[model samples]
Target: MKMNHGFSWQYDEFKQVGTDYGSKAEVEIYDSSHADFRDMEAESIRILDSLEIKRSNVLIDFGSGTGTFAIQAARRCARVYAVDVSRAMIDRAEAKAIKAGTSNIEFHHAGFLTYEHNDSPVDAVVTTFAFHHLPDFWKGIALKRVNSMLKPGGQLYIHDVILEETNAVENIAALIDKLATAGGKLLREDTERHFRDEYSTYDWVMDGLLSRSGFTIKSKHIEGGVLGTYICTKN
Candidate 1:
């Protein structure tokens, strides 16, 4: 699909705030820093299992980060597309793929709103901790593009920080305090910056966006009143 030239209100996802992941040094430290809280490998396997991915299936992981999930997915699927907005992240993920001897994974330096898939429609799309980069409207557009890239009944798994509307202020405050206790002052500051600067929206908003973008929510889980995981299928 061709992007519209006349559209002028698009968001630039590459221009990051709170953290600059474009630097090689930052990319190098990403895994270690996130490892304290995220067991990404286990999470990847869980997603694959949930999707019932077959050896013949093709998968695309948006915001592939350091390629941990992409490398693992490549081992189980026919092909894996690892897409990220940062060139540094793409380079690091490619190196990790090489080290792991996984050759079926293709790396692309792009984000949710910009990445275009020209090959056959994929079987599944997986994105974790990344969708909040876009504001709500662009997120809807991104979801439409993702839907276009998938065959009918294709699965999409999204894991990110999504807030609940009920007592949202208290929930966010409690989450920040909990994170601070678990990971120290750095995590505290990061959580503060995330709320202050990021685009994570309420659960109701996300539900509306997903439904409007032609996805049927098969399952949804919310953890710690903050993190939300939605397993959806293209309708």
Candidate 2:
């Protein structure tokens, strides 16, 4: 994937922040590890349904980990662009796509800051648990780029660890405790590390970023005060 020739001080997204997804071992265990808590296929179908994806539309999955959503989306859309920062993740996703007999997905080893969409504007852009890879400033910049990649009135869906200002500390503690009970020490530590190192921001900040980047927030949903989902349309 060709990178943008931006300022010299651009953030190096390839150098992962919290989890070392670049490691092949991490990539190998991602699916099983996440399966303990998430029904990825069901969640993907719900997202596709929420977007109202049509058979003729094109969609982009920004953090297409392991091709779960990408393959599912490919079955419903004309084409799917699966983009990720880790080459190992991309390779694993590609292998799974092949195994699933999904041929419409185009895998790209790129992140939000580095991905370049050369084709025509896509119908929608979907990302989950991925946007926090960048700090708030870079997230704003990345949203502007995402805005440029969509058609007029196209949709954008974001699901990530966004917080609420009220009882933020207690909420995070509760979330960590919940993860620990659900997936034991491994997931508990992962959740702790995410909050400590990742750049998850407040819901108000995310709303402002989407609005400033030319998106109209159609719907906003926050679960457990830590997980957030925003469905937006290009302005």
The candidate that wins on TM-score is 2
Angstrom error at residue 105, model 1: 0.6
TM-scores for every candidate against the unseen true structure: 0.96, 0.98
Backbone clashes for every candidate come to: 0, 0
List the lowest-lDDT window of 10 residues for candidate 1: 1-10
lDDT of candidate 1 at residue 98, scale 0 to 100: 98
All candidates' lDDT scores? 0.89, 0.93
Error of 2 at 161 (Å): 0.5
Which digits, one per residue and each the tens of the lDDT, describe model 2 over residues 138-170?
999899999999999999999999999999999
